[model samples]
Target: MNSPIIQLEHINKQFKNKLAVSNLSLEIQPGSIVAILGPNGAGKTTTMKMLLGMSKPTSGKISVLGQSPNHQQVRQQIGVMLQDVSVIDGLTVREVIRMVHSYYRNPLPIDEIELLTGLSEIDLKRRAEKLSGGQKRSLNFALAMAGNPKLLFLDEPTVGMDSETRIHFWKQVRQLTQTGKTVLFTTHYLQEADEAADRIILFSEGRIIADGTPESLKSGLTKRILSFSAQHGMIPGESASPSDTQPDHNNANSPHIHIKAQIAMLPNVDQVEYRNGRWSLYTTDTDTLIRDVIQRQLPVRDIRIETGQLDDAYAELLATMKEEQ
Candidate 1:
């Protein structure tokens, strides 16, 4: 394995009265895209600022490209596209890119940068203030890439971009990684991370909640939901009594019996509904539930089980985490 391009060791950052980032540690390898995912005020932006040496860490150490973040040489090798980047309104797109390129020793060709960023239609003579939000975002990316830095920090790089432009931007990002450039970005869009990043690090309450490849994170949280529609309206209880025939009776009427057993004894159970038919019940072991229902001669329809998608896994993981908290 290659050495990590960025390493954070027991990093902690605190404001006057609150700890924005706890003792967080992370390692980002070269030539790969790593996405940092978190909700608002989760210390994601603070961590990024510390990594860029824009804010001093309250404690711990950080290294970028095997050098301290404060080192000028290391800073020169890193490109930053902050969420709140402001450009000189009077400068044109081409002028801004050229100005940024002048700071680096060997910047990429201007024509190549323009093509890679899909800024060809952006008038080179048009002032930065005249561009739309998406165009401005693309210009920011173009300026960030002008330095030809080994590592790039993009904070919500595709914010305000149209769907087509966002797709185009990811393609450009992939091209950068192909040439051994490392990308570390923060995005709220899980789908964007799924499509763009090779690895994902999820943060919550100033802590690293999860870290792995997108597929691995998804598969680890994969659940099987057995769902079907019922032909008749029958309350789904967890357990049922062998002799209990009152379908309208609330499960609270018999608190001693297991609700799961009640569900097993129901006849013609097409699906499990709870709370007066408000919510549906999904289980991993549908075979047992189905077999039990079949043995009881229940008329079930459209019973099937399959792997849940990424969105389902993501919601389940977050909900589980919230419950634990």
Candidate 2:
């Protein structure tokens, strides 16, 4: 693989007594779309600001495009769409685009920018102050792309967009990567990361807890749910009785509870709950449970297995980190 477009080494940022970023290091490959994820106070914004030269790290090395992040020449090759940027009120959309375009010696054409960002004829004529929230975000994205940047930084770029607009915006992002542009973005929307990012880096308490392709991250969180409706009388625990189940209840003579106890003892099974004649088994290995059920002939119906999703993995990882701390 080629050298990374961006690299950070042991980056740290401190404010007063608080440490915002803690020994963080990361690399962004060329033409990759990387999504940075974390809860509040996870040093996400601080990390991005350090890379954009908007903030200085208290300690450690930072490089963008093989140069120091604050290097003058680096400015021409990068674009940023910040969540808190306020547009200048007096200019029309077209005028604002033209003004930013002038800063780059060889920027994209005004017409191409308009098309790529979904700026319409009416939008072009409207003053910056008059555009709706979604329109303003679109304008922000348009301004970022005005430089034909080699690397783009988007901080919640779809914050105000409706579902349809957000979908369209993701398409434009893919187009940029197709042309060999690198993108690093921070978003509260985990689904967006799952759908758009080539790789995801999850941060917690100012540290990276997970880093990989979305599939890889989720696959590591291997929990799956198996639900099946029992046809015979309910198992001992499946009934609403408080009485402890007799040992005989799960013996070979009693098939329902026997199968239930057998399943609960499986190597990968986590827990088993029964309600309304339906048994819900939580396990890390769904195939083993399925095969056992078939082998035991437990008279089950409407069996369903649900694989772990990215959101589930993200939550589980964060919760685990909190507990560990």
The candidate scoring highest on lDDT is 2
Question: Who wins the TM-score comparison?
Answer: 2
Give a tens-digit lDDT track for model 2, residues 109-178: 9888878658779878888888888888888898899888999999988998999989999999998999
Query: In model 1, which range of ten residues has the least summed lDDT?
Result: 229-238
In terms of lDDT, model 1 sits at 0.77
Looking at model 1, residue 311 earns an lDDT score of 59
What is residue 151's positional error in candidate 2, in angstroms? 0.3
TM-score computed on alpha carbons, candidate 1: 0.78
Alpha carbon lDDT at 121, candidate 1: 63
Candidate 1 residue-wise lDDT, 215-237, digit = tens? 88876754555554333324344
| For model 2, the run of ten residues with the poorest summed lDDT | 239-248
